[model samples]
Target: MIRLVCSIVAIVLCVWKVFNWAWWKPRRLERYFRKQGIRGPPYRLIHGNVAENGAASLEAKAKPMNGFTHSIVPRVLPFLHQTVQKYGNLSIFWVGGNPRVDIMNPDLVRDVLLNKFGYFTKMKPNPVVKLFVTGLVSYNGGKWSKHRKIINPAFHHEKLKLMMPAFYTSCGELISRWNKLALEGSFELDIAPELQSLTEDVISRTLFGRNYQVGRQIFELQTEQQDLLFQSSQFAYIPGQETTATLLLWTIVLLSMHQEWQEHAREEVLRAFEKNQPDFDGLSHLKLMSMILYEVLRLYPPFPLLTRFTSKKAKLGEITFPQGVQVGLPILLIHHDRDLWGEDVGEFNPTRFSGGISKATKNKVSYFPFGWGPQICIGLQFALIEVKIALTMILQRFYFKLSPTYVHAPHAVLTLQPQHGAPIVFCKR
Candidate 1:
């Protein structure tokens, strides 16, 4: 009788714990936010707002974007955009059992990133993401710092200068292929896959010490590796290539849309390379290209959403957040914020960055394409150098415009990508 009663008590306690975790705690947190005068879609059960969020995402993708407008917040992040539009900027929302407080104010974002309250910590990465993406991206605190220190020298500018030949070689192959397509006057081609292939090759050669030019024999051998992942350098390749490729693609499309800017960029590239093939010194001096790239990053940043978790009670601005709550910093929304970026926030104005990023942003923590604070992307310099080399080479040969088959839909699946492939007509210059 005693043993049976003890077993029943244990079972009862377990059930109560589950109930508290799945429902009660969430409601308590929800009420706390509500008391603070914050509003959002009400949390529902264990799923929270997941079902409604999914439905909104599907609805947004029901059709491609109608017009090629730079104001892409509605299309890319529909639910969050709608939430902000309805409940104001500083609002509350739920992600599963945790309350997510969406903070749009730049000062608040800077505070969260800088972890000013000493209560926030890095969000645990998704289990599926952990399977593939490794290294500095997945770490926080001391471990991330140690890993960053280990890889720091490889991405330094001087090291990248040594890799410029590899950059030029990979870009040369891409230019060669495109030159063939353009040889027969103007040609229509989907530039997305071509750019993806170019970035993959560039990463493979410079970082992996092997390229497709090395032939299929070694490729076959690599497929049989014992303990290693697909490639040791895949950590940098996946994230870096996706960002650089998308940046270059949009740079082409945006420039095609604005021909005068394209002319300006072409002139800059020509001046930089007037003596011979591009060198590190010459590439660094291409200020106009840098402005255009920064503008592209502003308009279509790769990592659209940055989320941080509170491990303990925290405060931002005037509001106090409870433990286990996630704070969202939607990069897209902040980048498009009219109050922070002035009236032309949605418009493509590279000249805003002509005075440099600090001046352009008024020295606020506003512009962070590669992120801010201690955890900024380590491969930022590598991505920049690779893309600049490729862009400089391309502008020297071809003038491109979006093909009629092209669609202007930009959506985020982890990173921002054109919904339809970037079909473009490349005319030989």
Candidate 2:
């Protein structure tokens, strides 16, 4: 009899644990949000919105958009886009059982990112995802502060000036390859892989002080790890490599599509350097190129969504978020918002940044391509310098136009990337 009783007790406990974890807890959170007047998609049991999210993603990916367009909302983020349209910007949503509040308001995004209080902390990515990459971007509090301090010197203006030779060398290699490919006047080539290699080479050399041949193993591992993360439904960052590569690809694509802007940027590059190798000072003087890069970054930010968790109960603007609620700052949505960026939000006009970032956007937080405030990208200066040098060198050697076979599909895995690789016809200048 006692044995039977013990078996019954074990079964009851297992059932209760499963119920609490899968149903009870999620329902309680749903009730809390509802009570607070926050609306979201009606939560389904166990999986919540995960199944729906996956389905929507599959559908979006299957259908690629036509032509060169900056509006990636429908293709890359259909679920969130639909949610905001139906429920509103500040609505709550589910990622599995976890209740996540989507904050579209720039004020709340600023508050969350700035993170003055210790209450808001980064959402710990899944352990498998964490294994892929972890840097200062993954840290919090004192650890983050320490890492930032140590890394700051590497990206300083003086340090970047020293690294210009490394940039020039890596870009020179790319130029040589492109020249060979374009020997018969013009030739079609997929620039995405080339740019990826170039950026990886730049990072290997500049950051680790190793040549591409020596650092090739590290880059390959990182690429493999990113591919693994991309296959997983759980969102996680692969850090610098993909983001930098994606940015370069988009910048090239945008420039190719807008021939006038491409010519203008090339002119700026030539005028700045005057047939000399691009130095940090001369590259900085290329205002037109700077404007073009800024505009490209605005349209396609590396990390589309930035997530934080409430450690303790906290108030953001008017709403009070309970402890453990995930808060998502949709960076892509903010960057492309027509109200914030005017009617030309979807259009690529580098002149928008002619007066610089501060004068370009309606609000300070609206234009956070590299993120904002204390947690702004540490490698910002380094990345920009590399881009400037590569672009300067390319403009000097060749001009490129979109190949007829090129498909314009921008999607986000860890970062925004062309769904079909960026194929361009490169011609000797």
Candidate 3:
């Protein structure tokens, strides 16, 4: 009789816990948001909007955009695009029963990212996803502070200047390989993998002071891990996941499409370091190159979405978000917004950045290619320096044009990448 009574109590306890977790909590959060006048797709129990989001993404990916265009909203984030159009700027959505508010307003995005009151914190990535990539980007509180401090010195301008030799050496090898491919006038080659190798070599040698062999092995492992993580969770965005490679490929493709700009940049590069290899000092003075890179980043930011969770009750603008609600700052959508960037938002015009980031965008917070506020990328200078050196070297050796077989399909695996590899015909200058 005692055993029977104990079993009944145990079953009751399990039922109560499940009811609270699966139904009660979600409905309560929905009510809270609804009271604030926020609207979204009605929440379904358990799965939330996962099935909807996944299905929309698959359909979008199946239909590739026809040509060179920055209208990636439909292709990259179809569900969010549709949701925003239906529900408005500050709409709530679900990620497996968790209420996530999509904060598209730049002012609100600034407030969440700045997090001056320390109420917002990074959404903890899944443990399996964390294994694939985690560093300063994943940490929070004291650990994040400590990691940033330790990593800061390595990216200092003076410290990066010392790494110029490594950059030159790696870029030189890449140029040599391209020269061999271009021996018979011009030859078509996929530059995506080559740029990946170049960046990997640069990171390995400069950051760890290791040789390319060691760096190559490290990058190979990282790529495999990233592939596994992408396969498991389609929504996850791992920082530093092939970011440099994707950026380089896009820059090359953009330049190919705009030969006039490419020529102008090459002229600037030549004038900057006439008959000499680019050094840190000389690379910094390539204003045209800098402009081109900024424009490319504006159109194709690596991490399309940046997510933060309310660690405690926090007020962003007019809304007071309850603890545990996720706030998503859709950086890509913001970058490509016509209202923010004018009608030419979709065009590749490097002149937009000729006056630098501050003068280019309507708002400073709106143009966060690397990111904004305190948690901005520590490796910004490192990545920029590497790219400048590589571009300078390539422009000196060859003039490249997009291969006819090249398809302009940009999609996000982790970072924005060409769905079909960037194939360009390289002719020795």
- Estimate TM-scores for all models: 0.92, 0.92, 0.92
lDDT of each: 0.82, 0.80, 0.81
Q: Per-residue alpha-carbon lDDT of model 3 for 44-138, expressed as tens digits?
A: 78878888988998998898686777788888888888988898888888887789999778888888888899989998879886666576667
- Over 174-194, each residue of candidate 2 has an lDDT whose tens digit, in order, gives 988877887789888888888
* Residue 265 error, candidate 2, Å: 0.4
TM-score of 3: 0.92
For residue 267, what is the lDDT in candidate 3?
95
Clashing pairs in 3: none
Candidate 1 lDDT by residue in tens digits, 1-429: 999999999999999998997899988887888888888988888888888888888898886776788999888888999999999988877788877889888888888888755676777878897665655666667766666777788988789899988898899998888888877888888888888888878877876677744522343355545323333355576777778888888888888878899899999998778525788988889999999999999999888888888888887778988778888888888888899899999899999999999998888888888888767888888888888888888888888887888889888876788888888888998
C-alpha lDDT of candidate 2 relative to the true structure: 0.80
For residue 175, what is the lDDT in candidate 1? 85
Per-residue error at 247 for model 1, in Å? 1.4
- Range of the 10 consecutive residues with the lowest summed lDDT in candidate 3: 229-238
Each prediction's Cα RMSD?
Answer: 2.8, 4.3, 4.4
